[model samples]
Target: MAWAGLQTALQLIYPPRCLTCGGMVESDFGLCGPCWRDTPFIGGLVCDLCGTPLPGVDDGVPVHCDSCMTTERPWQQGRAALMYRDSGRRLVLSLKHGDRHDVVRPAAKWMAHSARPLLREDTLIAPIPLHWSRMARRRFNQSALLADALARETGRTSCPDLLIRANRTRSLEGLTRNERFATLMGSIRAHPKRTALMEGRSILLVDDVMTSGATLAAATEACYASRAREVCVIALTRVANES
Candidate 1:
């Protein structure tokens, strides 16, 4: 009782701050009221494949977004916990470059909750890997950290070694779909030693953000090449091409 009370007192003295704005929040890894409202949580009727927010609803039928209609997505289903906008960008950038390891657990909890529909009995949770050079410079792979947290929360196998980055590509931002695909082709490959583990298992690819889905597609190609039964992609944030 004394220890619990002392801990509560300490918490009151040093209240948890919002992850986005650093304002005092009610809980750890949470947001203040304004920040909470500002967050663009990706919900509502979304695209069946790319998970982009749709304008309206339908009669329980799956609706494909404009990109999905013309472009073929390698993953079976893609979902993002938040729309990559003001708050989402800040949150992701903080995690990616700011070394904010505290954000992974809560963010993964949100991701696991939002992507629950894609979870299956034998899903292997994996991350879009970073090349050794990039990982060395960054000191960590943010996607791998999130994947590990997500696996712990969802009770899936965290398979960081399932896919390996064979080569590094330039930033895909501002590139067209074809250009992005061309750059990422042959960049990612499944680890030969662990390829057999993915032979008949479903894979849930976790990442920090999804912009053009190029990385996920390439990673999916690698996973499928190893005979994985299914590949699904989910991220903490996704760049919404439209409203």
Candidate 2:
């Protein structure tokens, strides 16, 4: 009962609070009710390739967005837990910039639920890596934490360094798709010693957010270069707007 006792003492020391408003919450890692109501969780219909919300006319069948229909994604499939807006934005910011370690468990649980369709028993879970410069600033790669938690939940192997960010790329905030391509073209590579773990493997690439998707795209290329048989992506949240 030491673990239980420790949990009780921790709870007493730090009462649960909402990640957004700092109001007391029922659990240690979630938003309050109003914040929960405001979250744009991605459920129901979404693009089969990129997990963008669809128009809801397909009656739950796999459908592609106009972008996915015209263009191809490097990964075979993708899923996202929420649209990056409202409380969804707060959740991501809390985890990534706020140093809210409490949010990882809840976020990972949501991601695991969203990614269940793409997961296989043998699939390898990996995180999009941070460049050394960025990692030194952030102190940790948030994606690595999520990838590790996802691996635990699914009983899959988590390869935190399978894809290494060899170089840092400029922020993709307002870049067009073509411009984004040039920016992230050679930013990532498969780790030399760990590439063998990816040979002919199905990989589930994890990340905190899919903004322009440049990061995931570059990471996917790294995985395929290592002879991974297939790759699927699961972002905790994704940019909601096409722009």
How many pairs collide in each candidate, listed in order? 0, 0
Name the runs in model 1 displaced over 4 angstroms.
1-6
Q: Which candidate number has the best TM-score?
A: 1
Tens-digit per-residue lDDT, 1-243, candidate 1: 999898799888888998888998877778899988999987888886777888886456778889888788988988888888998888899899899898898899889977887899999999999998998999899999999999999998988878899987898877887898899999999998989989999999988988778889999999999999999999999886632
Candidate achieving the largest lDDT: 1
TM-score for each predicted model, relative to the true structure: 0.94, 0.93
How does residue 69 of candidate 1 score in lDDT? 84
CA displacement after TM-score superposition, residue 116 of candidate 1 (Å): 1.3
- The local lDDT score (0 to 100) that residue 228 gets in candidate 1 is 95
Q: What's model 1's lDDT at 211?
A: 78
Model 2, stretches more than 4 Å misplaced? 1-6, 57-60
